[model samples]
Target: MAKSVENQVEQTKVLPQYVAALVANLLVASVGCAMSWTSPTLLKMDSGETDIPASSDEKSWIGSLTPLGAVFSPFLAGYTADRWGRKTTLIATACPVIVGWVLIACAEPARSIPLIYVGRIIHGLCLGVAFTVIPMYCGEIAEDKVRGALGSFLQIFVSLGSLSQYAVGPYVSYLVLTIFSATVPFLFAVTMWFIPESPYQHVMAGEEQKALEALQWLRGTSVEAVKEELAIIKENVREKMENKSTPRDLISTKASVTALYLSMGLLGLQIFTGIDAILFYCQDIFAASGGDLDSSVSTIIVGMVMLLASACTPFIVESLGRRILLLISAAGMAVSLALIGTFFHLLNNNSDTSSIGWLPVVSLVIYMIVFSIGFGPVPWAVMGELFAPNVKSMASSIATSFCWFLAFLVTNFFPTISKELGSDYAFWIFGIFAVVAFVSVFFLLPETKGKSLQEIQAILGG
Candidate 1:
């Protein structure tokens, strides 16, 4: 009996799921590169080092357009994912992003800022699809035991993509970087062509045979290895689809409405953590830091810190439990943001911050570390976990789209606020948001660490 049990455990293959998750996230990483592209390239534009001309206002619009484009597309994305399949949605979305990058690559030769705007908007539109479907696919395909770890790959890959841009953008020409960015979605498309659709998605489409095969493929094991799991998936899909999930259904029930609120609030606070402003304007923020480190080097260092933090999260998130990690992460970010605000405040007043030139980097490093572990990835994971499976798809689209809309507001106005009001005021405002997030985590957030999706929904259902 003991030998049989050990053999059963050894035969359970998880590597294939991990590989699929990683491949699916390649497009997400490209989104990151597009996000941070403006960070380095904006610097060149600001200083007239590039042939393309953008006034500060136009630059802000360029920086903010992706999120704005994202704001309007998630509902459509959800519709497509539900009707077609997660795999198809991911594959189809790649086309627009590739076109977007190509437009940006060609913009330099034309010296047209309008071309860049159109490219960014197109990229953003597709990104809404990526954000909507990726989490659904990741959460459904994973076993509950490893869901958090796998789900975190969403943010981890985003950071990895952004890090690649930060590390490479400063050294390369605009055309070279844009060309490289366009290639990422193509690679994602190629790799995704070979992976199976989520078993849950297949079940939703009433294809039990395909669902079984997909689960078997994703688990990298025989039918026997995944039989029980496939049964559970089928049962859940049947229950959830008694009434088809639609946007109107999201707010029809009290429990689902609460879940939607939780989703929006959780993800909304993540954006208010000032991550968009920090990432989009990383080079400028560092330049404003008055630090001894070169601005380009400083941006790279921050990107590295963010990437490492995001990578380490999946390893520890399960152990720490969701609420505790969030509490710690929120408090840490609040303090870090306050310290950064103080540094800026002092520097603005001519208080000679030469003695503490390192403060900004240290604070932001700490911010990235704590933010990555909890507020950064937990919201998306928990968002998927807490909703009733019936409303999950629509709920995800609303929450994700709302998050990007808030991101647009922040990214669009950050430059004006920093230059006109003061950078210190901006950081202080972000710090206050962090404080609210900490309180919310302590009082309202549930610890979702070891729970299955059904279990999580039960908690929210009450």
Candidate 2:
């Protein structure tokens, strides 16, 4: 056993390989999130050159398709990862993203809108696959102590990608931006070819010896530690296999079902609060608020603020705990949205342009900061923590699907809602969602801070 353990340790010490995998994972996630930022700019550019309806309804429909793709892609990718393996699924997903970007780049200015939707749908599908698989892959490979920090990097990179779009969009045409963005996914796919499969997936496939070897290579840990982890993984797999239920079995138990519901609700709240709407359409929002602000500059600033807040998350997430952060952030978001809504309401009601002078900008900045600190990081991080290994993929898929679905609703309705309900009422609606999210976090969210994935699973199981 000692010799075997020593062999495992020696095999797993391939630090370079792991680092490469981490980089690839980050690239994949970055490309996924960057799409959100790029699409609006691209659409605006296309609108300028085309005679397409350019109506609110048309814009919303375009926005809605991507999330619609996101809602379903995860289920397909999750199962594919389980059946086909993470590395293969990631590579396959990359192809569509690359194709999407290339198609977007080649589309004629006159023919671009529909092609743009196609590209978004394809990209959203890639995002769904990448989002589900990347975290699970990272979780499986990460050292227990550093898992939270490493896993949290997904959001950080996502923020960076978002920020990159804002920074890059004004300087480049849509075609150039699309071409540049394609490199991320293309490189991610190429790099992933050199990485090892997730050891957990190896173990799930009943390839214990391979699992041990993979874990040793990926983790660079002692044989004893690898064996201990392997045992835990095997037991989880055994339980899953013995149950003989489909993924739906995950929520068959009341507790598990409640957890799933709450997780989905949390994800839904993230979208329903109109964070994406505000982020994607910031220029419009600012213009509506009567600001003479340059849309691109304001967007870049917002993106920078988001990136800064995300950067701070890893430092505090493990120490401060997930629940508290969620509540605080939700409360902060509520107030900010209320302020934004009130400003817009005042403007709409009395045409009082003074309220938008500085307050709207300040409120938006504050709201972005608050959102970045809490909801931005906690949702993905907690989603990583909430589901048990057996059902994690399925639960994540369902939750993510719900999230995208609500995102579709919010993005699709934002223009109409703001137009009819007025921007103030629209923001007020988001404020109400934040308030509800605050309550949910206080009551339902578990504190998974400083806990390993296995430890979190145990807590959730009870």
Candidate 3:
């Protein structure tokens, strides 16, 4: 027992630096998600539209750009991270985020529709890079026992960042919000200079001693534990070296192809379920659902609920496990969507009286809670775990980029989809997707509970 306690202490020594880097990464990631939240609201206000897009054609075109950027940027970011190192890739991507925000803040003054699209596309590109790279960094740095917890927290901070935007959006001008959003990336870029690069990247670069020191700094472990961790890392690196090939060779391999497909499927599920569309247009959904409010105060309740659910994720994730939580959350979302859809269906049928006055509001809130709990966090966490180190960056980029593509699809289509199908059918479509996601999680995803990064890699046949 005494020896075990000593071992624990030794294990903890390398954690401080890692925690610092994690926090920095979280800040940047949160900002990236927040920018997405803020952009739609700012765009609507700047455009002076009574409803988002104002027309179906306009909506589809605008929404399509998001996925277009998402689909492309990940490949670029992922390859870049693998080639240049995660730190450099992240720092380089921050520049676009800054530029995107500046364009957004200047939208009214600029009065250009093309500029808004450009800004959003740039923001989407930055998001694609940040999402893929940050998770890879966190997963690489974390101790085995804490990896899930740390990786899961990335989504939590993303929620926090998103919630911050929703909180501030109503109270502040679009210009101020855009400027504030841009500041986070700039700060993240500056601070990252002080953080150490990933130990895995150091190892890949053949800096064995530097890699050991990095692991030591990241783990906060004693020298002996550091050595043990170093041995594991070294073995993993050697395996990767043995299997090393050009990107084309890597892509041609069966395991790599399987991992890529799984990544893309996971991301596609995340977007197809309509969460981003819901999140981006929550206020509009609420208003359409019979809640009466102007654009400014429209989604406050939904945003608050989303924020609360996001806050609860870290607490529940470990206790419930990713699979169970996701299943439960997905089930809840399906039920909520069904309820909301029913309400809309009733309203569409009746139109004469307020028969289901409270149903829409109640159902929308329930939908938001369900989403925040399950689909929002779990997909990102799973994506982070699904790939091995050799193909991690490429796989994650493909997944995240696809996620954005789907996000673009859903967001762009929702307004028009909602208009044509009516609120009832549009939500039902999401409900069906949620059910599909639940099944996928149950059958397709492996139990990654308490696994080390290398263990996870081994499971995936790295």
The lDDT values for all models are 0.86, 0.74, 0.68
Q: What TM-score goes with each of the models?
A: 0.92, 0.86, 0.83
> Which numbered prediction scores highest in lDDT against the true structure?
1
Angstrom error at residue 457, model 2: 9.2
After superposition, the stretches of candidate 3 with alpha carbons farther than 4 Å from their true spots are 1-8, 11-18, 27-35, 38-64, 221-228, 245-264, 292-298, 321-323, 349-358, 380-393, 438-462
TM-score, candidate 3, is 0.83
Q: State, as a TM-score between 0 and 1, how close model 2 is to the true structure.
A: 0.86
Best candidate (score: TM-score)? 1
lDDT for predicted candidate 1 compared with the true structure: 0.86
Q: Residue 330: error of model 3 in Å?
A: 2.5
User: After superposing candidate 2, which stretches have Cα over 4 Å from the reference?
Assistant: 1-21, 30-34, 38-43, 46-53, 205-213, 220-240, 247-251, 349-356, 383-389, 443-462
Query: How should the candidates be ordered by TM-score, best one leading?
Result: 1, 2, 3
Summarize candidate 3's per-residue lDDT along 212-258 as a digit string, tens digits.
77766676655556676677788887897786555684466655665
